[model samples]
Target chain A: MFDWLQHFADWLIFTVFNIDAGTKLGTALNFFVYDTIKIMILLFVIVFIMGIVNTYFPIEQLKNYLNKKKLYGLEYVFSAIFGAITPFCSCSSVPLFIGFVQGGIPLGVTFSFLITSPLVNEVAIAMFLGMFGLKATLIYAFSGILLGTIGGWLLGKMNLEPLLSDWVKEILKLKMQQTSYQKEQQTFYQRLPEITRAATDIVKGVLLYVIIGIAIGAIMHGYVPENFFNQYLGGGQWWTVPLAVILAVPMYANAAGIVPVIQVFVAKGVPLGTAIAFMMATVGLSIPEATLLKKVMSLKLITLFFAVVTICIIISGYVFNLLL
Target chain B: MSKVIKVLGTGCPKCKAMTQVVTDVISKHNIDATVEKVEDIIEIMKYNVMTTPALLVDDTICIKGRVPSQDEVFTFLSNNE
Candidate 1:
């Protein structure tokens, strides 16, 4: 499907630049150009389509329904799926978190939504498909949902309601009614400009990270020895998964930027599970997100949330390694 | 009719942009309105708004989750007035 892009990269690198195809610089440049173009195309299409879908999506209605119904344990799955589809930014996490909780959604269920949201979304899916192929993308998506479900379910069971901040508790006691904003309905064509602008803004926001990520990936693909990661991060060592997750906790990057680097890690000798776990930890459990959560949650709750999620990610990493 | 317009956001760039747009619109129209930027999460939560950059005209939400274009802002202000 993307043969033209690959050919273009080839022609540009070898024919136009007059570089030997076999040389490291030539190979790296080719990989960089091809992957960058392919990922950008995928990103734009996916984001644009999602923007359209979101325009018509009754998010307010859905949140109301989620609040009223008891979906048994399936709420976790529902939240996970919702998390996956929604194009969320970490900047909006606090408001979204408070909204869910105030809407009477169970705390664990809200956590499920929060956990899967950052880990698997349109940008992450697009990059995964472009770099890792369909099979890997499916596995990654499935694992992300599973992690959110189980992690959220467990957290819900912890009876941590007492850990909420006084401000949140006071708000909860008030039981504020969810405000239903009347959105003006417009035809697709009328909404097109706004949707297009939104899609463009999203692309612009992540472009720099994407470039930096792909550059690193290109260098690794061309210059790094094939067995370098395998020598250390390979061989199914238990510590590697935990270590990867631990190392990733402090580093923060959106999925678009991190996916390329993760791809290179897999391309080299690093275990797929460890690479994925690292990506999850980096995206899902961030210091900034924790700080944001501090508004509604006490220090104790924040610590517990991070600890629980870290353990869940590490476990999922091992499971993926064992199964795949 | 002097109105109070509150722009609720957590200080993200988009939020800042939304505030800027509202400010520009208010000045351009010479509308009788005061624009208040709400950056506090607890205060924003009182409005029960899940999305940031929500434009509230006299405490009634006109838009949320995205910044309104200048014309949209003008329409909102004129309608409320």
Candidate 2:
């Protein structure tokens, strides 16, 4: 088993590093630069497109339309789908949340949006496509949407509105103060500023996280032990999935920054599901995002959100392992 | 002297809340202080605060982890004065 693992790690390292038995150091440096630039440019394009989409779409109208009484399950699914398209992160989602709530969109549907917005962002989608190909990217995106919708529906069924902050409730109460006339009077084109503001805000907000995440990924690509994960996290170990999730909890980074790391892990024989789960947990449920969320959500709701998302990622990880 | 109260964050809700709270507290207390929302990471890094919603008073990190309560703000400014 040890020798097989070592061989696997070596194979992976060679494939990822693009190094032959006797490749020069300059070749390796060249490969790193080429990969990093390609990845970064892809990220920039995707984010820019997402920004344009976010800028052009009128989410408030959509939220209002969805606010009507309907089947909870379907609403949750649609919420997640909508979230996937929106270019907002957790921070940028705040104004949208406020808009949704004031528009009378159910808490659960809003939760779906909240969950999916950060989990299946454009940057992640682009990175996944770049590293894992279109099929894998599509799978991850669809799964994220599924998780977001299901999670939101579950939370909505719990009827946790009473648990909301007094301020939020107050905001809800004053919803009527701004009449629909005030809202409908503004066309989608007129809302460009708001969309631009949200896009720029999200980019600015997550830029550091992305940069740091990518930098870490670059270093891992360059020097982290190839077999480190296989030695520690492989072989259907009972502790592996939970341990990966726990380890990922305190880290505050983005998916784009971590994709290269994920590639490295997969190269080294780290279980596919475990690696993906670790990535999801680290990127989606970042410590900083959680800490920032605490200002808006109560401890109870936050804990529940965390638990639901963690379970989903774990299950997804296990499923990947089972299938792949 | 202008009492400087800095709200540290990358322009998230908590940072916005901290800015509001500081503004509210200063107004309520009628203190002659200016509240500046610091969105630049470098400026925030100078204070060595990693968390958002950090509150700094005249360069001292008054609150590092959580949003300061109204009472806590009162005591902090009072003590500083």
Candidate 3:
């Protein structure tokens, strides 16, 4: 479908710079052109659709659904899935967490949403498809959801709700007072322009990341040695996984924002598993997010959440390296 | 015309900060302005502000993607006026 764009890039590089197709410069230019257009188009379309769909899917339902869970294992599963589709960031995750707790959702189930939402979302999936292909993306999505479910289930058994902050308890008391709050009926007419605005806003925000990521990836594809990172960061080295998680914890970037960096890392021969671990760590367990959660959660629960998720990611990284 | 200041977000912390900044600016300046907080995801999209905590003064996007301090809000309202 994008063959014409690829050809245009090739011809431009050859004609303008007199560089042949086989040369390193030509290859880099080719990669940059092809990927830039591909990822941007995919980002706009996917984010637009997601925006429209998100408009229709009221968040109140999520709170209500988790609150009324009668199914045995399905609540955790569904919460993880819901976490993936929600169009908010780590910033929104806190209030959503408080909302869930106040709505009577289990703390474990809430944890499941908090962990998975930032790690694997629609933007991440689209970017991965443009950069890494389907298999790696599936691995990321699978591990993210699984970690949330298993982690939440285990934490549920521990029953850590007593550790919630006093402010949250007061909020629950107020929610009890407002027991008969009315729900608004949604209409398609009301959602149409809002959807377009969302699409435009998202596209504007991430376009630069896509460009920068593809640019660096292309440059790395042409210039970087194939074996540059093989000795230390490669899949063959088991410690690289944990090492990546540790390094990534302090960095702050959403999945979309960090793709270009991930592209450069992977292209320089960083193992896919190690690279994914880094990405998850940057998005899911960053310092700011932990600080925000501290507003409502005790230090012990926050520590446990971080420790459990970090361990899960490090383990998944090792498993992927071994399998792939 | 009373200036309309809309803070675009889903009521997150950053959004609250933006809202507070606008409120303080308005009261501090004694300006005739209406401050509205748009928490609905779709309503936020209407302004085409990607990051939450976007501030709009009379339909012009003045600040976005981060929280603005009271001084910044003061400057924005002054400029709009």
Candidate 4:
């Protein structure tokens, strides 16, 4: 599918630059150019479609339905599915999280949503498809959903209601009925401009990370020995999954920024599971997100949330290693 | 009576942009509406909005989940009256 891109990168590097394609510099620059453009194109197209889908999606209606139903244990899965589709910025998570809780959804269900929202989305899926392949992306998407469900269900079982901040506790005590808003009717043409602008904004937001990530990927691709990572991360060592997750927890980068690096890791013999664990940890758990959650949760609740998610991600890493 | 325009968001970039556009519309078109940024989570929840950057004119939600252009804001304000 991207054969033309590969040829273009070859022509640009070998003919235009007059460099030996066999050289490390030539190889690295070629990779850098091809991947950055490819990922950017994929990102724009996917985000544009997602923007339109988001505009038409009946989130208010869905929330009302979820509120009315007693989904038994399925609410956790429903929340994870909902989280996967909703194009929410982490910065707005607090309001969204609080809103979900106020609507009488279980804390665990909301937690399931929160856990999966950032980890699996259209953008991440597109990158995975472009970089890895269909099989890996499918595995990633499934694991992300399962991780959210199991983690949230476990958290829900903990009876952590007391861990909510007083403000949220007070709100919970009110038991206010959920309010419904009227849905606006608009033709697709009427909504095109807004959707286009949103798509452009998303592309602009992640362009830099894509460049940096691809650059590092290029460097690793050209200079690093193919067997370099095998010694450490190659085999399915029991400790590597947890180690990767732990190392990634302190750092935060969007999927676009991390996927390229992971691509290189897998190429250089890093186990797929370990690399995926690293990518999920980097994007899913962040200090900033923790700080944001602190506004509504006590220290204990926040810690518990992070710990549960971390352990779940580690398990996912192992599952990927075993399956793939 | 002045129309009450409440912009509900938790200060995300889109929310801020929504506030800016609404403010610009009120000044450029001289719409008689007061703009309030509902940043508090508790207050935002009261509106039953699932997404931020929601525009409420006289407590009627005109937009949610996306920023409206200046012209859209103008139309929303004028139509509300």
lDDT of 2 at A38: 56
Give per-residue lDDT, candidate 2, residue A212.
Answer: 59
Query: Which 10 consecutive positions of candidate 1 chain B have the poorest summed lDDT?
Result: B72-81
Cα distance off (Å), candidate 4, residue B26: 2.4
List DockQ for all candidates.
Answer: 0.59, 0.03, 0.07, 0.55
lDDT per residue (tens digit) for residues A209-317 in model 2: 6555555555565566667777777767867887788877766455456676677677666886787777678767877777765645789978888888888888887
**lDDT by residue (tens digit), candidate 3, A91-151:** 6666677767767888999888888888886678778877788788888888889888877
lDDT of each: 0.84, 0.67, 0.74, 0.84
Instruction: Give the per-residue lDDT of model 4 (tens digit) for A130-249.
Output: 789889888888888899999999999999989999988887778675444545766788778888988898889888888888899999999999878899778856898888888887
lDDT string, candidate 2, B1-81, tens digits? 678777777786556756777888888989888788877543443443333457777766676433455656666677645
Give TM-score values for chain A, per-prediction: 0.94, 0.79, 0.90, 0.94
Clashes of each: 0, 2, 1, 0
**lDDT (Cα, tens digit) per residue for candidate 1, span A1-324:** 999999999999999999999999999999999999999999999999877766565666768888898888999998988888877566677888878887789999989988998888778778888888889888888988998898899999998889999988888889686655656644567668877887888888889999999999999899999888888888667799989988887667555787888888888888888888887888888888888899889999998888988999999889888877
Q: How accurate is chain B of model 2, given as a TM-score from 0 to 1?
A: 0.89
Candidate 4 residue B78 Cα shift, in angstroms, is 1.0
Minimal lDDT window, size 10, model 4 chain A: A177-186
Q: What is residue A139's positional error in candidate 1, in angstroms?
A: 1.5
The positional error of residue B61 in candidate 1, measured at the CA in angstroms, is: 0.6
The DockQ-based CAPRI class assigned to model 2 is incorrect
Model 2: colliding residue pairs = A213-A257, A214-A257
Provide fnat values for all models in the order shown: 0.51, 0.02, 0.02, 0.40
